[model samples]
Target: MNVLIVHAHHEPRSFNAAMKSLAADLLRGQGHEVVVSDLYAQGFNPVATANDFATRADAEYLVYALEQRHSHGQGTLAADIQVELDRIKWADLIIFNFPIYWFGMPAIMKGWIDRVFVSGYCYGGKRIYDRGGLKGKKAMLCISLGGQRHMFGPGAVHGELATLLQPIQRGMLAYVGLEVLPPFVAYHVPYISEAERRDYLEQYRQHLLGLHQLPALEFPSLDDFDDALRPRNAL
Candidate 1:
């Protein structure tokens, strides 16, 4: 399996960067082809502009069925943006690694999605959940949280971790046609012991290696979630 790890954190010593590196070694050791997109290292622009598209016509939001085939077919994608499209094209599985900043992705990470997941790159002719550009691929989230897990608990401040990931889980991953899998989240970084951290890291690596044989995750269907659990609200 070709796994693309998109790391959004800026500090090399930060837990976010550490998680990305750990995942890379784990996947590569398993003999899976790995590609790491260190967005900060690459200085990716995390904003969407009007000039990305070659066409401005308003027929409809064309759903992308493949990386190369989107609203414009194969005319030409922006040179800068094309690089990421090429990366997506080469991966069977993608891991989005980042830290939760104000309950959301860093601006650059969101910007990468805005620019790279262009009309043809992500959308298709069908509606959300229908066949789309990322039809055959799988994606996972490797996120780190600064606050304690209690904040995201039932009686705490933030809410559950699952609810916090709705936007990325559904809006980004599933909306693009990739299977939304159970994300691997490491929370309460400030409190964990060295042994606990090592354990989590090891388990994380094991998880990615399993992707080679296991099917892409199908988010478990559940009942009645809060508004925070909706696609737009999940951080």
Candidate 2:
């Protein structure tokens, strides 16, 4: 399988960086082709502006999504965005590698998604959820967090980790029609010992090796919703 790892850590010596490298090396050792998009190393632009498009549908006003559609159609999208889009198209699976910030992804990685997953291609109108442009592809989040695992469950200091990730797992990934795999989280990363970090890397290796055995996270199918996108049972 062709795998794409979109790595978003600023420091090359960071644990997230180690995971990214390990994933690429391990996957390649398994005889699978791997591509790593080291966002910071590549100096990816995180800001979205009218500059994303070479030719705009409406030069007078700036509507980001609309311009995405227009530029994608005209083959006039910015070089960086087009490169990422091509990588997404080439991959059978995409792994998002990053350190969770403010309970979310880094701004650069979010911007990568914002610019690369163009409208009318990734999704538009009824072409969403199970029917999205990337329907056959798979994606998973491989994240590191400074918080302890125990602090993130019911009645704990924070809430469920899954709930906290609903926007990414459900809203962005599932909405774009990628089969959402359960994320591999490296918890309490900052405080963990070097031995513990090694253990985490081994765990991540196992996760990559056993990806096919893992069940995808449940999400709403377009079939379950009516024309208005309300649940069929609701109607």
Candidate 3:
């Protein structure tokens, strides 16, 4: 399978960086075509602005999504965005490797999504959820956090990890039609011992090996909703 790993950590020596490297090496060793986009290393610009398009669809005003559709159609997207879009198009699976910040992804990572996942191509109108632009592709999150595992879940201080991640998994990945896989999270990375960190890597290796058999997270199918996008069975 073709895999693309979008790594967002700033520190090369960070645990998140190690995970990214391990994934690239291991996947390649398995004879899979792998591509790594180390955002920080590349000094990737995560900011979204009118500069993204070489030509404007409207000179007076900017509607970001509409502008994306126009630029994409005219083949005028910024070179950087086009590069990332090409990578996404080529991948059968995409792994987002990053460290959590404020119960969510880092700003750079979020900005990457904002700019890279174009409107007309990734999602538009009725082409969302199961019918989204990346329907056949798969996406998984490899996230690290300083919090302990016990801090999350039912009645825990941070609540459920699943709930915290719903925006990315359901709102973004699923919205774009990518099959969302359960995330692999490393807890208390900054505080963990070297042995524990090694264990996390080993466990991640096993997770990668079992990718073919890993079940995707449950998401609402377009078929379950009516024309207006309301649940078909809703009273």
Query: How many clashes show up per model?
Result: 12, 0, 0
Greater TM-score among 1 and 2 belongs to: 2
Task: Give the per-residue lDDT digits (tens) of candidate 2, residues 102-202.
Answer: 99989999999888989979998889999998999999999999999899999889899988899999989999999999899999999999999999999
Worst 10 residues of 2 by lDDT: 226-235
The local distance difference test score of model 3 is 0.95
lDDT per residue as tens, model 3, 1-235: 9999999998899999999999999999999999999899889998999999999999689999999999999999999999999999999999999999998889888999999999999999999999999999999999999999999999999999999999999999999999998899999999999999999999999998898899999999999999999999987
- Every model: Cα RMSD to truth: 6.3, 0.9, 0.8
Runs in model 1 lying further than 4 Å from the true structure: 53-74, 190-193, 212-235
CA lDDT, every model vs. true structure: 0.73, 0.94, 0.95
* Candidate 2 ranges beyond 4 A from true positions: none
lDDT of 1 by residue, 87-127 (tens): 89899989899988878888988888877776655765553
Q: Candidate 1's C-alpha lDDT?
A: 0.73
Q: What's the C-alpha lDDT at position 186 in model 2?
A: 97
Each model's TM-score, in the order given? Answer: 0.79, 0.98, 0.98
Q: On lDDT, who's better, 1 or 3?
A: 3
